[model samples]
Target: MKISIYREKLKDKINNKKAKIAVIGLGYVGLPLAVEFAKKGFFVFGIDIDKKKIKALSRGNSYIQDIKRTALSELLSNKLISFSCDYRNIVKSDIIIICVPTPLRKTREPDISYVVEATRKIKDNVKKGQLVILESTTYPGTTEEILLVLFSERGLKVGQDFFLAFSPERVDPGNRVFNTSNITKVVGGVSKNCAYLSKLIYSKIIPQVILVSSSKVAEMTKLLENTFRAVNIALINEIALMCDKLKINIWEVIEAAKTKPFGFMPFYPGPGLGGHCLPVDPLYLSWKSRRHGFEPRLIELASQINSHMPNHVVNKVVELINSKAKHSILEANILIVGVTYKRDICDIRESPSIDIIRMLLEKQANVSYYDPYVSQLPIGKKSLHSIKLTKKNIFGFDCVVIVTDHAKIDYSFILKNSKLIFDTRNVFKKFNNSKVFRL
Candidate 1:
């Protein structure tokens, strides 16, 4: 595989303001990438199959809170960025970056259908001197096994006629500290030239560009980063549970541990791990490892612990409610605070709050939720809408459960108003009263 032409084109694209770039799958990752490239003076085409996303982007309305309206308006007015569902525009572009979702199946298997379908779109419009970089997070060998096999059918050859690389998207939704332009991007190419060009393209936008040996290493780097997070979160969650049994505050322990400053980094305990990347990425690696007759025991164990968090929270809720009064499980008014997967973000994909709400309903608890960012959340058969989080509303609930610890929620107000509080996120650091129970 050779990519001399692709390397030259990439260098030209980096310096040329008119060089066209097409970003496929305009979700959290793609939309931001498109905007950043446009801001850097490149003609960016944002493509997605969903007409709704295209329509919204056309009107300059963004679904992600991280993307400001003023920035999007500037990009739209300059005509540097465009949105479309058409594939013809993709073929017109010099560089195409795939940022589609790679979710898991029911059996926790890697589901690359989105990647496959998007790659097929690229194949249909693929031309010579095209550079295709996949920015989606997936198992190792996905670029080689899934995409390379299909591209070989075109007979154009990778790295020679067309360039290919795998660059994982490190988009942390709602994170104020890191954004597309600042985050260090990792890129690996099929060949040396392919990697060089891949680095050249992203280097224009990002502050630091890290290059690995191969595309597989770049793929595995993403999995390793997410898996480490999953395991550490699991360990902290286990400690929080043990602290409950021993009648100690986990928050204090974490704070004291942070003072060590040498071998310590603090990770908070929550109801469970949620969000698209941390919970889903590990399963991709675990499934892929099986092909080599290897099982990731650590990954599996962490998953089990993370998955069981909702159950642990629900049990604590039940115990707290039962001890309060002789009321039946079906009659208690349960209010769940913070519905989004994490704090301050509207994205609720794989949020453990959904699981907690479902389990509560199954146990016959009358569950109502409150999230400032989210209006309505779909859990099983019911569309649980967010009630106003106020002193009056909090006064009516039998017990308020803290699922997501949004900064907007007044912890003191909640601790004072609710009859009893089940603090799963440990947000109420100052509350020492008997009415508050930490899970």
Candidate 2:
């Protein structure tokens, strides 16, 4: 078939809800996206290497907090969406989206192995006239440099025999307002037809589809968005440290500055930068910049500041314990309020609470955690479970550190019971008490 004819056929299938949409890696990003596509009347297939996730989805259950179980059950019952561990589904898909993770290595460099592995699977099973879109977050030139080479090596001509594009996944896991269907989708392709086909597919489920000039542009767009967040968060964290030394409440200062409403956007300080995006994405940009003979000093510095926050929090805990408790840190019983990276979410990937727990353990402190969302914490070799937050358990601890300010926690109960409270998230700013120490 001619290239134009293939493009027109794919576009028609997308518009008429007849396209088989396959989403690879059904974790935080892929599950919600696959559900949205299926809800819009598209036949969606979800692929994942984790058998546990496959089994759960096959049984019409959702592991992700953002994806409701009822919604997933309805789609599974209607036969609009299916789950699989086999790569054979790629052959039947008209549009395939790769939502695999792009995490950092131990050396803090971009680990594109997951993206590469998923692309290789697509290269093996993909057929002619199929559209492949990379939704994984990575450095610039990934779609063109990595994916384009893979397809070309398989003797497939992109934009002719098959379509190729990059559309960054803008998923905020615990966010209630903006979701997969509401957030604007940004897409770019190696060729105009590739971009157009991707935009058509996303427009069916998304509110808006932004078409960029090229795939590299779309990749850089994601990096810029997260890098902006990382940099500003580091700036605010440093200010909070300064405010602590000067005896000024950083939360009050932020409130005063936020009233301007023109130039300043408030970013609260925390134990550290956590989650899948802020801590990992900026380093991908910095790593790519170093390859081109440019060092991203600001980004590197921001990472350093944010990385030190866990230590800073640990130091404050020690200081408060030394001053208030009759016993040293080694003998003190410490309790952590929340272990997840953010509030109202169960995701603990790259959470700074893990680092804080490790630091406290090294100091020989008796540490326990209470998160309504997370039930267990698996460290290097030991497994810690969440303790029940009773009045006796609350008062028994010498120090209670609020790492993640989850809304569901009883702040009044904590304030009335705990001996000394270290508020890393500034949750007790409104209540002025001698026992509460703000970070």
Candidate 3:
């Protein structure tokens, strides 16, 4: 009877546009989510520990690439959203969403300290008749084991006095196709009331809301999604290496295989896997699996292959310099184009281009890079700036390697003036020239 009354009250607040929504950890995921809710006519509070982010948002500015500045300014003008670095705002919010990052430690173990700490802050200000949902990705059983314990310690009767759920975030940075409004959101909770209430809140802003049986299922769903990508990427990368020895272009083979359209999904080969999801999410699952005495052999093997790709690229550079250029690697003037992890983004987290640049510098090569999105690289112990992409700059290098293929670059200008080119991303597929090489 008590659970029904609380559920009705929450549902009424959401339907009438009176619910005060709070989103914690305003980052790539949280900022867009908070904006989406505000766009849907709900009052929102954007909370984070970073004062710089809060200050910027308070001025009607957006730091995330996916969110537009005009939309943020409009929300601020309408008084639908506000930013804060305080946790006391959570007490007044009827629904709270956690969107903190779950990164790996230096030892490659799952570092869930951010999630745990966020839960502690939430517990301190939680009130009855409120709903809490976690959107950070982690191993299975994290919501049930870690978050539930914290709420329980507060003496709140969940499903009656409070509601808890897990809804993993599927944020793809720099992806223009899918955003927060259209993507399908999968939600799981500790009880039916929890799942229903959480689904109602998300349904107001998202296109689809899927309800699962338990929070553990939602957590595992996120891991499986990324692990599948990591494993397939490793498979295709190994195939690319083999294609090099067989004197066949892997890109050509992939283009032909993609014609069948049934049993094949094209996963491209690059220097290696980068970004927050592909390189880090798989290890979280494998680490958890090992605790139960189960060996995830496939996951480990994929990680090994992906991790060694930077070295493979370095070896290719050495071979190219030895066979074509007059100077050794120690005396070469190598230029790398594009340093970000992927194309058309400014984020540099776990980028393979950094490792490739470090390796080239270790061999005494005079290396310089040019990226239109990134103006400078502040790597460890050394800082390099992006050089201009003129004919004079192109002609001065021993070879130019295309590490990332941003659309804004003038590739024809480089090809017309460069002496030799090593293309890791197959950016020179249209031109047939003796000076161009593909990986």
Candidate 4:
């Protein structure tokens, strides 16, 4: 058979966990996944352009919250994993996985430059009998549009001389329950042989594997997952704004709806959508949708509502400052309790707290923050350090805003010490203090 040469060789290497795997872009998603592959006794080659990351990983120091330093040490001790900045090392690898970022441009269109660049590097070093799978979250046609064409330029036929697949990574930062070993790995490929080889490799580390028909379906699957959450969160955010106008408590409404337990999945409103998937993925889908001559109005509306939340939060603070404080808004002291995008993680990408602080400062309000995970934040030219969350520090502020409710923060202590509070995360739901206001 024509497929016997590449398929059988890959099957044997994967079955023995002897496959030389190369995982690119060691960030939130890439680092943890690379570690998992190492644990399974695979000779994993970790590649990234960041020397700081390579230095840390090479010395067995982990910068990500989810991957532990001890895991790196064990992997390094066994010589199961190696880190490098050079792409030429991939010439000896049997599999290459791309986990690079897919960000948006100033026009809000999908930016696949990172994906293209990674492909170009792979193109230079790509060899026959190597399986290339892209795990970066992108548009539907990206795998075929970029990977296949680039790799084939050097006369390597995909699925014959080399295998090609798209496996969308389902990595949730700080999610303890579903890590790489347990979550379902969704694989789709350009050909059945490509999908089979990809599944054989990923099945060595991940427990459940689902192979779809084509790479586009796998790409669309990942987008649909994030878009679903983005749209629903937007719907609830708009409802929260409606409740603010009607003197209704959105939290209480969500609690009431939770009793039914059927058809109602609660998505809380916040300063806005944060993290990588929710804010960015839907826009990828939307960009593709527009190109196909279809308008995703609801998705666009959701983005608008979620984006407006920080402004709404600022408006509430303005109302409180005018109503409760003797000082003018110019010199009012506003302390932000937490600064990270989500609770318990150091990730600050696309965080709404940044917007809230900027809006506050633009209003000439004094803004300082406290986050155990983040030490300091940059705004324009100046920087704001995480002040000590002491009683004296808490009392000095005119109003304290609970933007992110990290698990480590003492809510009761803050409630007792703050002069006035605007609770965005419902950290004060149990409290009956007259001075505590909730969004």
| Model 2 weakest lDDT span, ten residues long | 1-10
> How many steric overlaps does candidate 2 have?
0
**Residue lDDT tens for model 3, 1-439:** 2356888999999999999999999988899999999999999999999999899999988877788899999999999999999999999999999999899999999999999999999999998899999999899989889988999999988888889999999978778898888899999988889999999999999979999999999999999999999999999999999999999999999999999969899998889888788899999999999999999999999999998999999899989998998679996999999998999888888899999999999999999999998888976799999999999999999999999999889999999989999998999999999999988
Q: Could you give candidate 2's per-residue lDDT for residues 1-439 as a string of tens digits?
A: 2357789899889889999999999989999999999999999999999999899899988988888899999999999999999999999999999999999989889999999999999899988899999999999999999999999998988888899999999989888899999999999998988998999999999879999999999999999999999999999999999998999989999999999969889999889999999999999999999999999999999999999999999999999899888679996899999999999899999999999999999999999999999999997799899999899999999999999999889999999989999999888988999999989
Ranking by TM-score: 2, 4, 3, 1
The local distance difference test score of model 1 is: 0.88
The order by descending lDDT is 2, 3, 4, 1
- Clashing pairs in model 2? none
Predictions in order: lDDT: 0.88, 0.93, 0.92, 0.91
Better of 1 and 2 by lDDT: 2
Answer with 1 or 4, whichever has the higher lDDT. Answer: 4
Query: What stretches of model 3 exceed 4 Å from their correct place?
Result: 1-3
User: Candidate 1: worst 10 consecutive residues by lDDT?
Assistant: 1-10
RMSD of each: 1.4, 1.3, 1.3, 1.1
Using lDDT as the yardstick, the better of models 2 and 4 is 2
Tell me the tens digit of each residue's lDDT in model 4 across 58-176. Answer: 99999898888998999999999999999997898999999999999999899899999999998899888899999999999999988888887999887788999999999888787
Q: Cα miss at 66, model 1 (Å)?
A: 0.6
